[model samples]
Target: MITRIFPSVRRLHRRWFYGLMAMVMAVGIGLATPKPSQAGLLDLIFNGIQYIQLSNLSTQDEVRLGRRIDAQLKRQGVRIYNRDPQIVAYVDQIGQRLAAASARPDLPYTFQVVQDDSINAFATMGGFVYIHTGLMEEAANEAELAGVLAHEIGHIGGRHAVNQMRQIALAQGVAGALGVDQSALVNIGVQLALSLPNSRADEYDADQRGFRTMGQARYAQSGLVSFMRKLDERSGARPEFLSTHPDPGNRVENLEAMLESEGNPNATDGLNNSAYQSKISSL
Candidate 1:
């Protein structure tokens, strides 16, 4: 054994060891101070995914996204022609009326019609509810359109997108939390939302809102169900709209249940096959 190692020299190693410990403690304290990040790396990633998927967005941002989509339709030469401003006004009137009674009235609800023949109606961010000429043509009457718009409004008023976005943000990474760009999120979120089945929770909420709006506004709640019922029989027989807003064959049943639950006729919709077709034809 090398007793040649003196005790004094050996004690010297202790000083170095103590210094190293102090440095590590300083690093730990610096980390604990929490300057900006409240989440760990994993937390940040999870948040991003949670939010961008369908959850956390402000009303202002939502309206902005809707505006962007409206602009895009214009740039793409999409037809948004409304031959009769009254018809357009009628649609907005219905939308506004129901929106006033929705769960999230703070949303900026706006309704528009696109003169497209795709048999499609979709809801965009903010509160943009779009009914395509094709959708109007297919609907038996205004109540049908009201039902459709009400459902879209439900999507906005329920804050479905906002809640979905929060989940996505949680799943996203640190970079996502460090000021994630919303433009990219909407572009990405739409894709995700399109693929993923709208949660039963959302479907249920929209169902409630749609039926209530129709009933309260004196529109035909049954028309909402009727439109969905015939999707299996229509020429398109289930448009891309289904992918965005899926209903597993219980649409009428759901509406009926809602009506039974509500105990009244909210809206009066008698299907006018010829009238609907004529109005849409002008588009």
Candidate 2:
């Protein structure tokens, strides 16, 4: 009877040991697992659901988003081209003309050139459009520069950034963006400016909008096509503009389509002036 009892007691001990080890391993996995912030899974799920229900942003929200991006730009030490008021004014004048012809003509557009030599340009929320000095130098004439500006203005007019921001908020689970949390705007600004580019669809929409604006503003529709051709020729080793804008060939094709639909208007509607060349050369 003693031996039989001893066997039973050993079996019980072995069972208990195995159970304890299993429990320890479960707890170890729980400790090692990476969690999403302090918000936990439930909060992230709720935030994502709430964001999905949101439709349109208010005008005030758009302004706040722009201000946050402007702040970030300043903090990043991006140099604004201001050495020559004449050159600056010239670029702004061209931008203003395009904006006047854009769908959202009432928006207060602000066009600025950066001192960087890289051939790139971008537009953010609100009416802010930035042109790099290198892009200005690369453009063959005033019309070519206008083509670039109109494309950027098209992005602003179409609220493409707003669409991009909505996507970012959903992916990252910005708890405050769906509510009154203003800090979320700051995060959105940084991500939009530094990381994300507009989707291919968005790029195509901007291309169409710009073509219309150029035609309405009498900027010579060929300006866009010509500029794209030149851009394609020089696009080597991953251009900065290519990161944001589509491939130059695709853009050129789109612009040509617009021209074809419009009965093929003269490509030289806008021409370069001596004053325009002088201003560019001085830089």
Among the numbered candidates, top TM-score falls to 2
Residues 1-283, model 1: lDDT tens digits:
6658788888998899999999999999986675655546546566663332233445666677667655665665656757888678767877888788777677778788777776667665678777877777777776677778888877777767656655665666422434555555655446433344567778778878877766766667777777777675556456756776776477657776776677345356546667666655555
Per-prediction TM-score, please?
Answer: 0.68, 0.76
Q: Which pairs clash in model 2?
A: none
Query: What's the TM for model 1?
Result: 0.68
The positional error of residue 48 in candidate 1, measured at the CA in angstroms, is 21
Tens-place lDDT per residue, model 2, 1-283, is: 4545588899999999999999999988875674666346456566753232224676656765677677788688778989989888988999998999999887778888899988889888778888999888878778888888988888888888877776676677664534524456566766676557778888888888888898888878777878887777773575578777866788788778777788236445556656457768867
> Residue 140 in candidate 1 has what lDDT?
76
Question: How much is 30 displaced in model 1, in angstroms?
Answer: 16
Estimate candidate 1's RMSD in Å: 10.0
Question: For model 2, what is the alpha-carbon lDDT of residue 243?
Answer: 78
* Residue 261, model 2: Cα distance from true site in angstroms: 2.1
